[model samples]
Target: MTKGRSTTWQERIDIVQYCLAHQHDYHKTADHFQVSYQQVYQWVKKFEDGGQDALKDGRGRKKAPEELTEADRQKLEMKKMEY
Candidate 1:
């Protein structure tokens, strides 16, 4: 969290997307986002490991996807059939 300016959750996500789309121009991106070159690199890394979700407000750690229990899934399918 650098000083001077702060970005919203959506803004951070957009910055990551922009960095991924323009990886070849790292300096340009740094200037556009008003951040350092290393920050741009970090954003690209986050996008690569995960998708847009990685850019959101959090501890910057990825939690494994939750899996539905076998019984729960069966119940859901049964309910869907009734509709």
Candidate 2:
């Protein structure tokens, strides 16, 4: 969404979902999502405090992680597990 980062909406949603499902364990969520713990925590905070709109990457605001989408990340992990 930003110049260097390309975080997707689904990724944001998935991150928040995973964190919520895991009882808001930032470190574990971060590890499972392959992102920084702080990122997971911030996403949870944003999701909880602002809902879906908050996860949106607003222009002129701080950028989120720029890597694989949720599906891609999950697929990659599945592939890794297969190997």
Candidate 3:
């Protein structure tokens, strides 16, 4: 949740929950969460700043092609059948 980098929604939630539950020993909680202490710290910060919504998935740029249009896909199928 730092520097505008995207993180998985589950990661955010797990990190926050781990820290909250083990606040007495954050180092152990960070290890249990499989993230650096810094990440746990960040998630806790985000939770404090914006509540549960802060733990939602971060949006990122995707590299895949868009879904084909219905018409275009039907035309392609028709062409295949004609062959």
Candidate 4:
């Protein structure tokens, strides 16, 4: 992998597979993949519970629009008129 900090989904899966084939040895997996032991453990757990989908970033996260009060709309209209 490059010097970039983030790893790709495929890379995570490969690491998980290696760990699994090695009898779930977290420490060896981490050392072999240049990652933390905890990371290996979490990835395996996520993979087991949710398959590859769980390994993706922002699994359930979403950006929601900000809620605006009526007063906020009035202020926006005033600002538009001033422009």
**Index of the highest-lDDT prediction:** 4
Clashes of 4: 0
Clash count of each predicted structure? 0, 0, 0, 0
How does residue 19 of candidate 3 score in lDDT?
74
Residue pairs that clash (backbone atoms under 3 angstroms), model 2? none
* lDDT per residue (tens digit) for residues 1-83 in model 3: 12333458876776677677776366786667566667667678888899988876646944333566777778778999999
Model 2, residue 73: C-alpha shift (Å): 42
Give lDDT for model 3. Answer: 0.69
Assess candidate 1 and give its TM-score to the true structure.
Answer: 0.55
Flag regions of model 4 displaced more than 4 Å: 1-4, 59-83
Name the weakest run of 10 consecutive residues (lDDT summed) in model 1: 59-68
lDDT for each residue of candidate 1 in 1-83, tens digit (9 for 90 to 100): 33336677778777777766775477777788887777677767886888777767677665433566777778778999998
Over 1-83, each residue of candidate 4 has an lDDT whose tens digit, in order, gives 21325789999999999999999999898888888888899999999999998898985765333566777777877999999
Please tell me which model should have the higher lDDT, number 3 or number 4: 4
Query: Which candidate, 1 or 4, has the higher TM-score?
Result: 4
- Score every model by TM-score: 0.55, 0.62, 0.52, 0.65
lDDT of 2 by residue, 1-83 (tens): 11223569889899899889988888787776677777777889999998999998777864344656888778777999999
> Which candidate's TM-score is highest?
4
Error of 3 at 74 (Å): 35
Instruction: Quote the lDDT for 63 in model 4.
Output: 38
Candidate 3 local Cα displacement, residue 37, angstroms? 0.7
